[model samples]
Structures are given as C-alpha cells and as structure tokens.
Target: MIAKAYLWYGVYIILNVLTIAGSDPSGGAGIQADLKTFSALGVYGATAITALTAQNTQGVTALYPVADYIVAAQLDAVFRDLRIDAVKIGMLANVENVLAVSSVIERYKPAHVVLDTVICSSNGYLLLEPCALAALRDRLLPLASIITPNLHEASVLLGEPVAADEVQMIYQGDALRALGAQAVLIKGGHLLGNCSPDWLIEKSGHTRISSVRLKVIGTHGTGCTLSAAIAALRPQNRDWTNAVNNAKIYINQALLQSTRLSVGLGTGPLHHFHAWW
Candidate 1:
C-alpha cells in the first residue's frame, strides 16, 4: 500500500517537453516558438539553444552560435532529471552542433522526436552551411521519428529542385523516406497557390492536408510552432499521422484567428495568443 501511494504521487509530477533549436530575439521562431506552442497546448517545455540570431519579423540580421559542448551540456542537464515526454529539434547552426545533438538524441532515445529541418529562413537566407546539411542527412535523419522541411530545405536534401506541387511534394516525401526518416512532413507554404497542401508521409503510406492560404504577412514561426505542437501531443499516445493532422488543425485555427493582428514590424508573427484570450 505504501509503494502504491509513492507511485501514484510520483506519476503526477512535472511533464517536460524538450526542444533543441536556435533562439530568435524577436520571439517569433526557433526555441521561443516551440516553447510557446508547447505551453499553449498544455505541456511544459525545456530547450537546448543551438544558436542565437538577431532578427525581427523583417529578417535575421546576424547570428551567434553556441559552443557544441554547451549544447550537449544543456541536454545532459535536462535528461538527468526531467521526465521528458517528447523532443522537437530545430535549426542546428553548424555541423558540430548537429552531431552533438544527434549523439544526445541517440543516447536518451526519447519517446518522440520531431525534426524541423530549418535549413533556411523564410526570407531566402541560409541558416546552416553545406557541411551541416550533409551532417543532418547522415546523422540526424535516421534518428528522427518525423521531420518537417519546407520547400527550400527539401530541395537541398534531395539535390534536385522540388516543384511546388502535389506530385513533387509526394516525390520528395518518398525521397525523404529513402533518406531514412521514419516519417516526413513537407510543408507547402512556399508554393504560390491558393491552396497550401502539407504532406505527411510515413513508411505505411501518405496523407495530404490542404488549408486555405493565410493572407497574413510576417508568419515567421508557424512551422516551428506546428512541429512543436505535434511533439507535445505525442504523449497522448496517438500515432504520427494523427499527431501531424492535429497539429495542422491547431496551426490553421491559430492563423485564421490572428489573420489581421500584427505582432512585428515586418512579416508579422503568428497570433499565438489569439485563442488564449
């Protein structure tokens, strides 16, 4: 009876969601976006900052990367005590950082791992070097349960131009699977079309979801938040497909609700708090 009481008491302790990503001073993307999305979805978030960028809604002006050892230390500290339920990985600014993060992930082997292949910014700036992308493809791709990459990043991964269309996205999805991701989500926001289709493909099959184009500008952190939401929901024991779909619904609702609200000077940030109020 005493053992049962201890078990019950401990089971209700803090729920931690881990995120590995960069930091945006503007609070629109990277670790900030992931944490906000996790909290909005009723989960606790912890982060290992990979890089620091000085940027606003307009664009990134400069970047400062954290030491690789420090990145590893953050993960070590978090996994030591926290009952981390899931993990979301974002921008790894360099090759060394990517390898370090991959090593930690393999060691801990968390319940769920979501990889956001943030190789570039929305404004056409390269976030990672060529070597870093190669490291991610070789080291991290196989470890991730699911990887979310926008068009530009996908093109870089596949070594071919990914057409911004259904056929192309599916083709690239298959290619990503070939690269060894357990699952892949190819975001179609870069496509110049009225309907934006996000493809979620896995080893079993493929699923495509379409949303009306959000007319709002400055939607900097939508991808980061969406991926984080998926990571946070994995603790509910839903499969990858369900998790991705639910995350899409959450992001679409958030975008629709905050279509008119402006948070930054340039390319506005998503209205993350719209539903909270």
Candidate 2:
C-alpha cells in the first residue's frame, strides 16, 4: 500500500522533460537554455549533452563533441530512471551524435519532442556539420512532434533561399512538413518587419502567430527558448497550436524583460526566469 501511494505521489509531482543537445558555457543556448525554459514553465528538466562549446554571446569559439557512446549513456541513464513526458533536441555537432540521439528517440519514444534545428550560431558560427544536418533530416525530423526553425534554418532545410515574406515562409513550412515533421513552425524573426510572425503548418491547416518584434539586442537564445517552452507546455496543453502560442507569449515577455539588463557584450540572452523574479 505504501509503495502504491508513493507511485501515485510521484505521478503528481512534476512533468519531467529531457533535453538532448550541446552545452553552451554562456548559458544562453543549447542545454542551458532548454533547462532554464523548462524550469520556468514548471517542468522538471534532464539533460544528455551531445557536445561542449566554448562560446559567449558574441559567438562560438570552439566546439568539442562528446563521444557517441557517452551521449547514448546519458540518454540511457535518463530514460531508465525518469518518466520523461517531453523532449527538446538542439545542436548536434556531428553525424555520430545525431545517430546517437535518433537511436534513443526510437527506443524511448517520448510523448512530446520539440526539435530546434540549431545548425548555426546567431553570429554565423557553424554548429552542425553538413553530414549531421543530413542525418538529422533523415532520422529525427519524422520523430519530432514539432520542429521550430528560424528563417535561415528553414531555408537550409528546404535547400532554398531565405524566406523573404510570409508566403514563402508558408511554402517552406509545407515543404518541411513534406519532409516528415508532424508540424512545422517557421519563425519570421529574421524577416524585415515590425511584427515577427511564425507560420505553424499541420495537416489540419495552417495559422499565423504574430507578435510585435521587440527592438532589443538581447535575442541570442530566442529559438532555443521558444522550442523548449513548447516542449514544456505540450504535456499539459496537448495541443500544438496552444503550446506554440503560449511559448510565443512567454518568449516575448522574456525578451522585453531582458532589455533592461546588460548580460554580455554581443547579442545578449533572454531573461528566461523573468516570471519567477
């Protein structure tokens, strides 16, 4: 009876999420951003690091990918112990790491998976190799519940030019859906406009989410934050549109709050914990 009671208590404690990505020393992106966003949104976060990056707000200086076996071991440890409700995947530095992540996803099949196709840094540093990108497209896209890609990353994935306007963004979203993701969110923050709009394309239909683009320098981790927020929200909401909408609201507030503080020299990071303080 006591054991059953303990199990019930554990079930109600907190929704657990696992983030498989790289480590950013600056804490603005990668696993750091995912964990922060998950915690802020009331989810318990676990991590399995694919790489370690020496970087700051300005850019990534160097990257050291963890061995494939090590990445697999971390994922195994998390899955064997935690009842993970969601997953968020970020920068995979190489093909081996991508395969490692793919293997675990197939094995565990977490309920919600948000893949932030992090191929490059905000400052134009390459995070994933060409082979890694191919691997991700082939192995991981079909598994993700939703994929959040900025204008540039979407362009890369679709093998075309940048999405110059909303029409093109929608086209790209559909194209990405054709690639196998359950839903595609093409972020328009890089577009030239007063409002940043994201196109969410699902088989049911498509919708646009637009927010006033905050003219702020602290926008380093926006993609990671958005995707992580979606992953954290999915378990409760169980609706992709609501999950994405809530994430956008959270990110907008975080960006607004971050503008007041000075964190780094270059493109700064969002105040991920703004709600708490």
Alpha-carbon local distance difference test for all models: 0.83, 0.88
Best by TM-score: 2
lDDT of 2 by residue, 1-277 (tens): 0001113454646778888889989999888998899888888889999999999899899999999999999999999999888899998899999998999999989988999999998777899998788889989899999999999999898789998999999999999999999999999988887899899999999999999979878888888888888888887774899888888888989899987768788989999988777
Which residues of candidate 1, in runs, are more than 4 Å off? 1-14
Q: How does candidate 2 fare on TM-score?
A: 0.95
Report the lDDT tens digits of candidate 1 across residue range 186-273: 9888798898888888888888878888786647788888888888876664587777767777787777766667577787777666
Q: Choose the strongest candidate by lDDT.
A: 2
Tell me the deviation in Å of residue 269 in model 2: 1.0
Candidate 2 regions exceeding 4 Å error are 1-11
Could you tell me every candidate's TM-score relative to the true structure? 0.93, 0.95
Query: Ten consecutive residues with minimal summed lDDT in candidate 1?
Result: 1-10
